[model samples]
Target: MRHTEREPDYIIKNDNALINLENSVKSLCKHVMLRQENEHLKDLVIDRNKYETILGNSTPVMKVLRLIQKVEKSNIMVLVTGQSGTGKELVAKSIHYNSPRARKPFVTVNMGAIPEDLIESELFGHEKGAFTDARDRRIGKFEEANEGTIFLDEIGEMDLMLQTKLLRVLQEKEVTRIGSNKSIKLDVRVIAATNKNLAQEVKEGKFREDLFYRLQGFLIHLPPLFERGDDVVLLSKSFLTDFCKENRMGNITLSKEAVKFLMDYKWPGNVRELKAVIERAAIMSENLTIQPEDLIFANG
Candidate 1:
């Protein structure tokens, strides 16, 4: 959770700690954590540095920040929806790092990347000899995140069978590892993110309606970078400055023409893409000044 997202290609890591602190503090007082140590948790999360890395003045961004403040304190399931590279995981990390569970393990599992047959074991662990490859007992992500938070990314890709098991686990607040009858209790906060339109997926029978509704205890939708107006300029300068300082390069500035060029293009890849382009431009430019000609989109 050092920077903007799970995507490390472009996220500057310096300010994310502050951002997490700021965003996480706003919500700690809003909800009573379902724990005996609510007061301790509050003390653990709140800090002096309040401003987090989320930089935007646009109404849409402001609304998202306000919602983060409202939802950060509770243990309710959170669903973050947006296009890929829109910083869904960033939002998820902001909540976890700024919450009472900041010191606990923050385990992340990418549902879409795991093979369907193995994901269940990856999430809930497996007893020794549970499967041919289960040579030893394994601790799953959920168990590892006990008393902390588990971020399930690309949840829309989880198959129906696993979805059923996951729903049961969420409902019971416990997990039974494969080949084991004993269920292990957990106190993990759940945060899930997806780029797919889950409503549409539920309609198509690809996603479970019950699970969809269950994940919607609090929903946050991240707008694509293109829709955030001048945040692009703010972000551009920030990234420019950080990249220069990080590399020990002399001060670098984006020419006015380069800024105009950034504002004009529709960033289909969102914040992640913008950061990559700027970092690349910073390196590819000949001098401290970055002009329009220095800009280059990686895939475009």
Candidate 2:
């Protein structure tokens, strides 16, 4: 007898189920791709804002801006030297965010803030049970910054032993964890900043001479605010506008007397001090116009 041939019902249902699963996966992948695109656009916007924040029209400030534009695309070790509050960290951020590594991680380590005993582990990571507080495996800043940038702020404060280790990492492009013999290769760009005079420190045997040369592959010196001339008024106005908006206050302007006072005063704390003074005046001013009397100087 010839049997009637037909596909079983279960086989047909299985085929439909597979087709639905395939469609679901495609939908999930599309969502993931769209999310990634949105994140990239956000990063672009942030980078543009960072560039704009380094504002000034004075010759000295313009020169620094030009240098930033020139070096943002290259992978080089930058040493930014200036007095305290001169915006050395800002320079470092501008370089990292404007460069090709903009999309990558920007890790910052304040050498002055980290304790000497733990700095090595902080930079190179450590294995589980590596030390007393090591309860789990930890990844260090350098590893986290692979294919990105690492900003070493207050680098002059680092001790000699750690400086030697840092020099080795720069030379070899690799790092060995605290308790492991294996080495992990890295592709991080390093940007260091300091308010101290590293050259003087090197001469005094407080800093390593070899490491100093290595870090100063390119150096950018930030002029103090007093030397920047009329840029003080420009920055003052900008800060005033920002503080006003942030506090939801009406628009404010500096009186002629106030402007003169700002221009004449010596900015011992540099741009940082100027910003603080403006913010205080913005809050303390009785009217939309900020007067000379509203300005307050920090104790010398």
Candidate that would win on TM-score: 2
Error of 2 at 90 (Å): 1.1
For each of the candidates, the C-alpha root-mean-square deviation to the true structure, in angstroms, is: 17.3, 2.9
* Model 2 local distance difference test score: 0.91
Give the number of colliding residue pairs in candidate 2: 0
Runs in model 2 lying further than 4 Å from the true structure? 1-34, 37-45
Q: How far is candidate 2 from the true structure (C-alpha RMSD, Å)?
A: 2.9
TM per candidate: 0.82, 0.90
Q: Write the per-residue lDDT of candidate 2 for residues 1-300, one digit (tens) a residue.
A: 122244456677798899999999999999999989988886786567466588688899999999989999999899999998999988988898888888788899999998888899999999999999989889999999999899999999999989999999999999999889999999999999999999999999999999999988999999999988889999999999989899899999999999999999988899999999999988888869889888998953
TM-score, structure 2 vs. true = 0.90
For candidate 1, write residues 39-72 as lDDT tens digits.
5764455332123467788888999988888878
